[model samples]
Target: MFTGIVEELGEVVGVTPTAQDSVLVAVRGPLVTSDARHGDSIAVNGVCLTVVDVDGGVFTADVMGETLRRSALGTLRAGDPVNLERAAALGSRLGGHLVQGHVDGVGEVLAREPAPRWETVRFRLPVALSRYVVEKGSITIDGVSLTVAEVGDDWFSVGLIPTTLALTTLGTRAVGDPVNLEMDVLAKYVERLLGARPADAPVPGPVAS
Candidate 1:
């Protein structure tokens, strides 16, 4: 689990393709890798990845085909900046809602409305994930937690303060750029609990008269 708080902005040092459509990505993140060891999980651009190797302030992780297909991480190349976050500790403050570091789907930047101290950015939400978003609700974009300022059937907007604009990759995201998006996990859970039973679920029998 992660808190959706970006601890560092790391750079992609290399990307090497492996067999079966998987790839090995090497990232340089001094802060996150300071105490990282093999098998440790790190959230990079909102996708959870396990460390495969650590060398010279850089760590390598294997990006499976599934993750690549589901996230914007597939577009990453050398020198691209990525948000990095270490796993949440047991007693740490829950600065953000519980994040599984799972990229539910990919969203594209639609527009940016700049202001004196803040900016409102709109994103094209995937149809399948739109129902999970609500006004003023929390959402994680590219690993940074933010509140939904405005929501439409297929789009949502977020107001980014200067701190967010300066600290994370979102600051530089241009229109049409793809971003990994994770809806509030709690909302999904609630929807599941209240939704109709699964196809394989046994139907309730009629009460005996």
Candidate 2:
């Protein structure tokens, strides 16, 4: 599990495809790499990846076929910047929320506009995932937790403060760029529970009336 709080902005130093339909990604993240272990999990751009190797300030993780197919990591190239975060420790303050570091779906940045002190970014939402998002709800984009300021049928907007724009990868995103998105964990759970048994579903017969 993760908090969806980006701790470092790492750069992809190299990408080598493996024979098993996985790709080895070498990233440079001094902070997150400092104490990383061989099997520790790291959230790369919101995708939970296990540490395959670590050397100095660089760490490598394998992106399996499933992750590549479901996330924007496949679109990344050498030298691209990515948000990085280690798994949340036990008993830590839930600064953000319960983030599985699982990318639900990829979204595209539709627009960006500057405000007096912040910026508003509009992202094109995938229809299948729209039901999990709501106005004022929390969403994780590239591993950073953000609040949804507005929502439409196929889009949602977020207000980015200066800190966010300066510390995370979203600050430099361009229009049409793909981003990893994870909807609210609570929302997903609630949806699942509510959908399990429909209101019209017949209840168990009471006795043998």
lDDT of each: 0.95, 0.93
lDDT of 2 by residue, 40-92 (tens): 99999999999989998999999999999999999889999999999999988
Candidate 2, residue 151: the lDDT equals 94
Clash pairs, candidate 1, are none
Candidate 2 residue spans exceeding 4 A from truth? 198-209
Which candidate should be chosen as best, given lDDT against the real structure?
1
Which pairs of residues collide in candidate 2?
Answer: none
TM-score of candidate 1 relative to the true fold: 0.93
* Residue 41 lDDT in candidate 2: 97
Error of 2 at 209 (Å): 29
Candidate 2, RMSD to the unseen true structure: 3.6
User: For residues 1-209, could you state the per-residue lDDT of candidate 1 as single tens digits?
Assistant: 99999999999999999977899999999999999999999999999999999998999999999999999999999999999999999999999888999999999999999999999999998999999999989999999999999999999999999999999999999999999999999999988865767878876789999
